[model samples]
Target: MPRMLDVSNDVRAEIGDEEADRLLAGDNAPGAYDCTSCRTPGNTEQELTSTVLFVGQETAVLAFAHATCVPSQVVPVSEDQLRGAVRSITGEDTAPSYAPPVPAAAHAAAPHFPAPAAPPAYPAPAPSPASPATASHTSAPSSHAPVPQQAVLGVTSGVVLVGREACPALVVEPTAPIVRPGSPGHGDEFLQLLSEQGFAPVVDLSRPPAPNPGWSVLLAMGRLHAVLMPAPGGGRPVAWWQAHSPMPLSEGWRGAVGRTRKVLIYAAAAGTIGTQPREDQLRAALDRAAARGALVGASMPLAGT
Candidate 1:
């Protein structure tokens, strides 16, 4: 059986003519699939399907989409994001985006802190309260009530697979095992602390929730430069982690993130996933944490550097 396919030169250059021909012959391609871009149904036998490649530091994921929804192109992503996508496709447990129940006594026992100084200006329009539904496409920051910080989070960039799909993801590893700001002897409670405040642990990225206000990942010239934290009091996005110099990203990473306004974010309890060229190592570390239920995640829009 023959199928209508639009394999771009770039894809052809990477996958080669033999594979491309195989796809057109319906020997290797799927009959129907969810469009990588729109997440809607697509039939390769009925309509033209674009061959999209998601390239990361260590792996490449080939996905299909409607020609109208997404032109064939290579997307770059982090290992963590790719793993999440894989989970979604593989039917792994996807945590609910809603905040989990917290004991009233726990909240009552929480220590109080002084109000932070007035915050700075966020990028565009103010953001709205988070909903587990669709992500907000607006460039504006969220307007939710401000949340205070206790520990600093260290972030790394990579791609993850939801299933056979791939997308860019940010991996957050704390500089130190997270403890309350004033407490010096507290144990690692980073993921637990965020969970208590409504941040959910995401094992799958197929149906991620809208990002909470103030968190963003910045890419420039195909390099990851900073991870912006929400400013105190709903203020501007500030760099929670900025490279001493702009760090180059894996091939196609910036483009992958550019094509998709959304990016997945994963956080571990504490520990360095290592550095570049070792993204695979980082992926393994985070994977262990995720397996042990020590990870939290979200999908946020890309922000300017």
Candidate 2:
């Protein structure tokens, strides 16, 4: 028979005062709560709930009860024990909340801005002709042709073009993703990409470290933001992006293309970190970030690349 996994520590740690009370109150873990004293289940007869009493910063006591369970049978638990149980069961830390003092000067000033101008009614340009014979060319072409055609190149160009056309319409707003320093595996690479894209990468290290098994990265472009985290099967990180404002794509991101046109190429060159990411996944993540007025990009190194 396969050896049973050790759950004693996990159980002990996860069982907070509240959870313990619930357990004693015969609150169903999900379906049925068992009564240790009378061998009776609680939730079967009524709903069960719990209340928490914070004793200190790191400790809390909990009380639990089923609608049918007697008030006299409730058990008390310490905050430390309760927190430990939560960690063991969920593998997540309970974050503490801190309130910062507001600046006095911020409230003293009234906001001011220039008056808005009337909207322009410019006519749309006619479509360009494919053949030079029917086209009126005002500018001379550079001696060198553009970069060779490649699937990755095409994808990057498309992203840049979208940003350029959409920016002018006030649709795209540039934003950056929040990243923690010293995260394992390809975090530096992700940061480098953001810097190249003209974003000032900010690192927040105030919180305790998490068990980051695989690589994660964040990127942002105007109105494009993304957060890429590790997938369950441990391949490439998943990307999530969103747009921050409601504006037409054609005008929202105008003038941004020149700065970002080369970014996708660099990201593609970086390739997928760990296991290669699927094209759809990357595109989806980019789209999410772009929509949010930020961009989050990440790359994992393949073997020998």
Candidate 3:
């Protein structure tokens, strides 16, 4: 029987046409699956299903979601989490059991993070809240500009999975309530303002945010500087949020930017997402914000000094 599977080009490219065909043919696809995005039961034979592949450092797990909920794509995650997800979906533990150690000769052929004699390039591991980060003064390019009460903007750096890559992301939040430029009372309208500027609500994190042209996150000397958007009148780009003092990027984040050369920017109203000490925590907060419609995001090309 044929399944209503939607294997996107990105997923097809990674899993190869042969494997994708097998899935489409129902040889490997599950008849009923718990949609990874919405966590609801779905039948591939009845409705369109998306094949979401979670690729970790070592293991890869294939999961299914509603195509209406999220498009088929690959998401990069830690090996442990990947195994846990596999267990949840398959109802069988995926943890590695005891096995005989491989011979040293074979170990030499093993593939790992760094190649032979390669430098250790890791980032997003050193969770630091006392680092040389910055607080910035940014602007909002909205016809409905908000009046910042404590308008001081906070920028947090982290890496998020978009498709098959670990891409750099910035979370921007204000310190206090932001209202209309001449509002009489305290009310948060940050998300509304950003919507007018092209940011989209994040219904699912598995898919990348919508592209936001004429806006970008700038880094100078591998340091986060500001988020620039098209000027209101038209001369040079202006800051939506400009770091008063640029913050240094981690080796991992800088390397990711070097490879992808793009950044995903997410914003929430004041107090929606606080300063999280770790990336995982930050991701969790973003998830909560997204669930409640407090999150807005845009994928912008990288900009510089």
Per residue, candidate 3 scores C-alpha lDDT tens digits across 1-305 of: 87999888866766678888988898878787665543446899999987766555655666776676556766444454454455544445322211111112111121222211110011112122543332223332233343544355567778777667788788877666666455676767667767877899996777879888888665432345456676655644555654434355666666566667678888888788887766767778888999998899998885421
* Between candidates 1 and 2, the TM-score winner: 1
lDDT of 3: 0.61
Candidate 1 lDDT over residue span 149-246, tens digit each: 33334455566655555677776665445544445455666676556544687654455535756566654323344456665566445554444333
Best by lDDT: 3
Best by TM-score: 3
Worst lDDT 10-window in candidate 2: 113-122
> Local distance difference test, per candidate?
0.52, 0.24, 0.61
Off by over 4 Å in 3: 1-128, 131-148
**TM-score: model 2 vs. ground truth:** 0.17
Candidate 2 runs further than 4 Å off: 1-16, 20-28, 32-192, 195-305
The candidate, 2 or 3, that scores higher on TM-score is 3
Please identify which of the two predictions, 1 or 2, would achieve the higher lDDT against the true structure. 1
Worst 10 residues of 1 by lDDT: 98-107
Clashing pairs in 3: 138-241, 139-240
**Which wins on lDDT, candidate 2 or candidate 3?**
3
CA RMSD for every model? 18.7, 22.7, 17.0
